[model samples]
Target: MNRTARLYALVEELRAAAPRPVTVAALAARFEVSTRTVQRDLQALMAARIPVRAVPGRGGGWSIDPGMTLPPIHLTAGEASALTTALAAVDAATPYADAARSAAQKIEAAMAGPAAAAARELARRIVTLPRPGDSAIRTAVERALAEGTVLLLSYRDAAGHESDRAVEPAGLLAADGRWYLIAWCRTRRAGRGFRLDRITAAAPTGERAQPHDLAELLSGSAAAGAVRPTALGPLPVAIA
Candidate 1:
């Protein structure tokens, strides 16, 4: 493999062995490279803000922080199809090029031979429907989700009067060509859904909200919204 490909593979190894430190010497031995080369790779990872730390002394090596999850590399055929389609749809959206290019590179780097060729071919052939205007609310929701923080939102009602609300953002959901925030509202004291377009301003509250049972919240909300009570009982569903 080339140096760049080998470096990517090394990152995978370090991330998989996270919280269990691996020394530069050990990595060099695995890749048949010099210890200096391994150290350079570690430096590259640190520059990317991957949370890699080097320990001091003979027993020390390098390690990633626990709970750091890399984006999944192993994609099934169905998943690959879905990703290509989604990427095509969002291709023209603002600042989407960076994420789309990054995803394509990761997939290409991870796969080999025929599989890589097929993925590229599929991506080339797909087309996405054009969407009008910027999706600022969707972008804000994603940022909040990634940082694990609450969002303070200024929302405008149908009549155009504005009100503020604090929500512990659980996740973002795309339904019927629009994005929605599936969140727990502190003011409402219940799980609520907010249409992204209705939001005027969203700022991080600088407070990390406590994690809740996402499945329970989604289930109860769905049950409450159901048109008719089930004859037998509430149908079981898994959320999150």
Candidate 2:
């Protein structure tokens, strides 16, 4: 790999083994480079304020701070357009709906004048059908999920039984043009999928949400077939 690619790869390597140092010789062998070159690249990464640190001991070499994040790589005009198209294709009721729109805006802003315009034009040609739900409810769901907190929900079931529920926001599931909050329902004492439209009212409880195994939560559940795991982890996307 070139210096630039190697540098990015090195960050990922360290990040993957975060809190666990990788010896210099191991990194050099993995990247097929000399130990001296690896040391220099590590220096460059530190100079860039990438939160990389050296561990000084027999089994120590280098590690990246777990909280550190890298800036996104540059995108070509086509790539920019593809991102915009994807954002446009997402249903409006999806969690982080506003953030998704902002991401498309950021992608366009990063592109050159002509490329940005071209991406916009291409994005304009695409259309997504609107899903039924209040934007405020979606916003509340997004907040609870992003903050990793408990959600206070006034939900009405299909049988028209309305009840208040305290749920731990685990992830979102979008299916059949509607969105579901796949959360741990404290009231029900089990994993439940609350349809966004059925949520009459929602807010964050400010309590730390407990983590649950998403796969286990959805196992043998009816919604399982509607959500397929992607490389992006457990954030549910509609099965195409």
| Residue 25 local lDDT, model 2 | 94
Which 10 successive residues of model 1 have the least lDDT summed?
223-232
C-alpha lDDT of candidate 1 relative to the true structure: 0.70
> Which pairs clash in model 2?
none
Instruction: List the RMSD of every prediction in angstroms.
Output: 6.8, 9.7
Model 1 residue runs over 4 Å out of place are 15-20, 34-36, 46-51, 56-58, 70-101, 129-140, 143-149, 186-191, 208-240
Q: Please give each candidate's TM-score.
A: 0.65, 0.63
Kindly give the number of clashing pairs for every candidate.
0, 0
Name model 2 segments beyond 4 Å from true: 1-72, 225-240
lDDT (CA) for every model shown? 0.70, 0.82
Encode model 2's per-residue lDDT on 102-218: one tens digit a residue.
Answer: 667656655667887888888889886776668888888888887888989999999999999999988878676667889888888999999998999998778999998676777
